[model samples]
Target: MTWKDKLGLVHIYTGNGKGKTTAAFGLAVRMLGSGGKVAIVQFMKAPKAYGEQKKIEECGALIESFGLPKFVHGKPTEEDIEAAKRALARAKELASSGEWDLVIVDEVCVALGFNMLDVGEVRELIKSKAPHTELVLTGRYCPEELFELADYVTEMREIKHPYQRGVIARRGVEY
Candidate 1:
């Protein structure tokens, strides 16, 4: 069914702290509760690598994840670049298809942070989304340039964190 809202707005969740993806997933569930269609294209994360992957899929949201098994610290490898390109292409299709009420580009800012994807391409992806599609972009290092295109921009600043105390990312908590 087509969305009946007045408009679909762009949302950005970015900062150093956690919960960006969590917030996006929260909104996904909220939209699904009302029988809205959702699609999530994950960048820089491999398939079935995160806890939410299976659960979110079980909740009936379409999930597409792409990334190399290893993390990129400095210059990204050719595989990393290619994977992100594919993810962006799929995200572009979903965002502009008008078949989904919400389309999320998860960890996109991290891909941008690593230079795996171009900011200009991302800007165009946002602009090309269907007028009735609600878009949510999640991850850290979100460029200031994107804020102007969004209707809602929330930053999850890190005042304190378990990582500072030498804690590792716990499954189901950080992943």
Candidate 2:
């Protein structure tokens, strides 16, 4: 309801590399293992194709996806923007409800980087989150403001990625 009621845990995973989403999902699974309620807010992807999304669904956590499908480097359309806004609203409600122990915002920084949402709005949502909530945010090129607000930050620096060799993403590995 107010900033004083907000949580203390936050993490940011960023950089031009793989495993940001995977790492966050791992944390979510770990929290679930400990009998914690969880929610995942997916940005720039859907629930249909991702392995992690499917796994979380079967595990019974609340998982929601937003953003439209676009090929790499494609610009977002207006519909995609609206979906992102809707997803943010849903995430805010969940975060403020004090229902989830862990909440992951996958690829949120990428959405902000594309100007789909404002950093201030996201910061406000984080500020309004419930006490004891753990927010995990993942994406490349995270804004410094988000980083400054984070209690922990991890950057997945790309050393060698198969994408450079034209390797398609393998299910269970990338997705």
Candidate 3:
């Protein structure tokens, strides 16, 4: 009944463009629709800020987000660092528990880029995941070394974005 043997693979969605989280959530939807379990640990994003959080949960996926209301820029504050660490710990536990078919660590690369998280910890989390768990990592500035460790590494290079025209993030599109 368990598809554990077939589910162990690492996916990385990174780069400056959009759709990294979208891709991850898309996979989450597929998994859940197919009677698979999923868990998402979001780093550097507040739980209530995103529209997907509520809807994804309604679709039977567990989501936990860690971050302050304010976005971290340049150097992160202690609160940001602590939140990232908490998210990291939860990600490790869920990824290794073998309870979910899909495990996503969202925005973790941003945490790494901002120095809120160390690549070593993320490296270890990937290494320690359950054998049957499918892992997804999302965000910009993903460490090149991690790409080498992934089974599917997708870089969403910005071809064009509405941000260039000064359009801000809109609900249901960019969230």
lDDT values of the candidates? Answer: 0.92, 0.83, 0.92
* Candidate 2 Cα misplacement greater than 4 A, ranges: 1-7
**TM-scores of the models, in the given order?**
0.96, 0.91, 0.96
Model 3 alpha-carbon drift over 4 Å, by segment? 1-4
lDDT tens digits, residue span 1-175, model 1: 5354755799999999878999999998998898888999999888898999899999999999987778777899998999999999999999999999999999999999888888999999999999999999999999999999999999999899988899998998988
lDDT of 3: 0.92
| lDDT of model 3 at position 67 | 79
- Ranking of predictions according to lDDT: 3, 1, 2
Cα lDDT, model 3, residue 11: 97
Ranking by TM-score: 3, 1, 2
lDDT tens string, model 3, 1-175? 5565699899999999889999999999999989999999999888889999999999999999987889888888888899999999999999999988999999999999998888999999999999899999999999999988899999999999989999998987977
Per-residue error (Å), model 2, residue 123: 0.8
User: Any residue pairs clashing in model 1, and if so which?
Assistant: none
The regions of model 1 sitting more than 4 angstroms off are 1-3
